[model samples]
Structures are given as structure tokens and as C-alpha cells.
Target: MGPEWAILGATSVSLVLGAVVGLLAIRLQGIYFAMSTLALAQMVYFYCVQASFTNGEDGIQGIPRGVAFGVWDLSTDLSMYYFVLLVCGAALLAIARLVHSPFGRIVAAVRDSEPRATSLGYNVSRYKLAVFVISAGMAGLAGAVKAIATQIASLSDVSWHMSGELLLMVLVGGLGTISGPLAGALVLIGMATYMSELREWVTVVQGLVFVVVVLSLRAGVVGSLSGLMRRRLQAAPRVSAASLPGASAHTSGAG
Candidate 1:
């Protein structure tokens, strides 16, 4: 199948799966929801490991780099890169719009305090389920692109470690901000490449970074920087006002 087919198939499957799981799991929150999803993931993983159609760990290999609608040949690395960029750009744009929409506001409201949202006559459960499905579909699209880019689909791609890495990326970059995850991914990828030789210590380093961010910058890199810039802007007016000759004198006289 072609890129379009693969992407559509991935997203559709994820949406279905997410809806089913979310319907069953959305009533639960925090660790319970996390555990439920983890259990589902384990089930999928074992199925992949046992299923003959999945190649039993060897995975689906030799996947062809097919052309895009017969117009762009993805066999060439440059063409494939550009195609990936296009797909990613579109996805990011869609995500931006989604996060800024009224639906997104409802999602945020639900997340902050479900009881309050419910009291306000909002269907918190439905909103949660819908967002869950949307998230899964987005993840599926990413997975589809990844498989195409690497030309391989393996169990490792679905492992708990992979899930943890995705969480870490959002935390490191800053949650609730579009640029945060992108920046976090670039940082993590760059670090991984640089430390490829010292792979054993990579996790240790990442953990240390995580700790530092948690203790000193709860808002994460992007969030912290944004806050700092905002604070500076706010303080600038006061500083300029205080610098005026009459302003200081007036304040001193009042004191």
C-alpha cells in the first residue's frame, strides 16, 4: 500500500482501538487509567510476539519505499525526507488548530477538574473519550510515518520504553505548548546521536536532566523561558516608570 493508505489505515485502527479502550477506561483516572492502557499495550505486544503474521519478532522487513501517488518517487532519500516533512507539517498544523479550538478548551477544562466540568453540565467522560481517540489517531499517524521512514516495523517500536520516551519528550519540552515537544524531541534525538557510543550512560544522563528540570524548572524548558520573557516584559514598564525623575521623588515623598 502507498503512504496515504498506510497513514489512513493506521489512524483509523488507532481511532477505533482508542475509542474502545477509552470507553472502558475513561471512568478510571490517574494511575488506574495508566495501568489499563499499559495492560492493553502488553496484550498487543504479546500478540505481536506470538502472531505469525507479525513475523514473531523479526517484524515486517524489506518494506518498499513506494512513490507518492506515482508523482514523487520516495525511493530517493531526498524525496522521502521532503514527503515526511510535508506530512509532519500538516499534522502539526492540524494539531495547532485542534488545541486552539473550543473542543480543546473543553478538553483542558476536563483535565483540570473533571468534577467542576461535570457540575457545569459538561460531558467530561465524552470529552475525555474523544480526546483519547484523537490522540491515538495522531500517534498512529506518527507510527505509520516512522515505519515508512525506517522501512521496518518491530516490537521495539511498541515497547513500554518507547512510551516512556514519548512522555519524557513532552515533559522535557513543556506540556500544553506546541513548540515544547518539538524542541524536546530535537534535544533528545541530538543527545542520543551524540551519546550513541556511550549508550549505557545515556539513560542516566537523561534521568539527571529530568531531575534538574523537575526541581528547578517545573514548567520545563520552553515554559520556563516563556515565563521569564513574560515577567521581563511586565517588569520593564515599572522599571521605566521608576526611572523618571518625578516618579522617584513622588514615591519618596509619599513614603
Candidate 2:
């Protein structure tokens, strides 16, 4: 298939898979949903390992980096990078739109208080299912994109570890924030790349970071920064008012 077609196929497949998982997960909350998704991911990983087309341990290697626009070769790193960036960007944008829509608001509402949403005549389960499916599809898309990026799709792509890693990225980057995952991905991936010699230590570092963030910073890094900015904005008016020539004098006299 053509380069664009391959990307389209990967994106579509990911969306479908994410939607399916999301649908199933949305019915349950908290740890149950997490466990269910993890199990599903493991099942997919095993399937990839056992399936003939995926080539088991050897994986589907040397996948042809197809031609883009029926002209530009995608095999080159530069071309592939741009292609991936574009696809990932588009996916992120799509997700952002979903999160901002009325439907997304309902999903958030369900997350916060399913009973309330249900009482309000909204099918909380259905919304949860829809969002779960969307997230699952996006996860699948990420898997497919990574496979294409490396030109190999193996058991590793669907492993529970991979799911855990994605969850970590979301958490570290700030769940519920559009840019968090991207930042988390970059930081983790970059660190892993640079510390290749200590690959085993990566998990330790991630765990420590997670603990620190959870214990000390309820909001992730981005969330905390956002709060700080909000506080500054809110305090600006107070500061300006206090700076007025008679403001402090009048307050002191009144006291």
C-alpha cells in the first residue's frame, strides 16, 4: 500500500481497537477498568506472538516504508519522522476535539459522578463506553504507528508492559491534560534513549517519580504549573489595587 494509505490503515485500526477496549472499560471504574484493559492488552500481545502472520518471536520485520504521495520515499529517517509527526499530531488533535465536545463533557461528568449523570437522563455507561473505545483506538493507533516507525510489529507492541508504560506517560504528563502525554512521552523516551546502558534502571526512576508526584504533587507537573499561573492571574488584580496611592492608607485607617 501507499505511504498515506498505510498511515490511514494504522490510524483506523488503532481507533477501532481503542474504541472497543474503551467501551468495555467504561462500564467499570478505577482498578477494575485498569485490570480489564491490561488483560485485554496482554491477550493481544500473546495473540501477536502466536499468530503466524506476525512471525512470533522474529516479528514482522523489514516492512517496506511505502511511498508518500506516490513520490517521496518514506524509508528515509527524515521522511518517516515527518510522516509520524503529522499522523500523531492529527490523532492528538482529534482526541482534543473529542475531549472538548459536549460528549466529552458527559464523559467527564460520568467519571466524576455517574449516578448524577444517570439521574440527569444521560446514559453514563454509553458515554463511558464511547470514550473508552476512543482511548483504546488511540492506544492501538500509537501501537501501529510505533510498529510502522520501527518497521516491526511484535508481541512487545501489545504487551501489558506497554499498556503500563502508556498509563505512566499519561500520569506523568498529567492525565486529563491534552499536552501531558506528549511531554511525558518525550521525556521518558528521551531518557531511555540516553540511558540505554542502564535500561533496567529506567523503571526504578519512573517509579520514584510516580511516588513523588503522587505524594507531594497531587496534580502532575503540568497541572501544578497551570494552577500556579491561575493563582498569579488571580492575584494580579489584588496587587494592583493595593498599589494605588490611597489603598493601603485607607485600609490601615479603617483597621
RMSD of each: 3.4, 3.5
lDDT tens digits, residues 1-255, model 2?
Answer: 675676668767777777766766766777897788778878877888888998888888987777877887888899889888888889888888888998888888887887899999997777766666666567656766677778887777767777678777778778678898787788678878887888799778878887887777667777777788999998785557779899999999999
Query: What are the Cα lDDT values of the candidates?
Result: 0.87, 0.77
**Residues forming the 10-long window of minimal summed lDDT in candidate 2:** 131-140
Return the clash pairs for model 2, or none: 14-137, 14-141, 18-133, 18-136, 18-137, 19-133, 19-137, 22-132, 22-133, 23-133
Q: What is the C-alpha lDDT profile of model 1 across 32-122, one tens digit per residue?
A: 9899999988888998899897797899887777877767788888888998999989989998999899998988998788899999999
Per-model tally of clashing residue pairs: 0, 10
Candidate 1 off by > 4 Å:
238-255
Q: What is the lDDT of residue 29 in candidate 1?
A: 79
TM-score per candidate: 0.91, 0.86
- Give stretches of model 2 more than 4 Å off: 18-24, 239-255
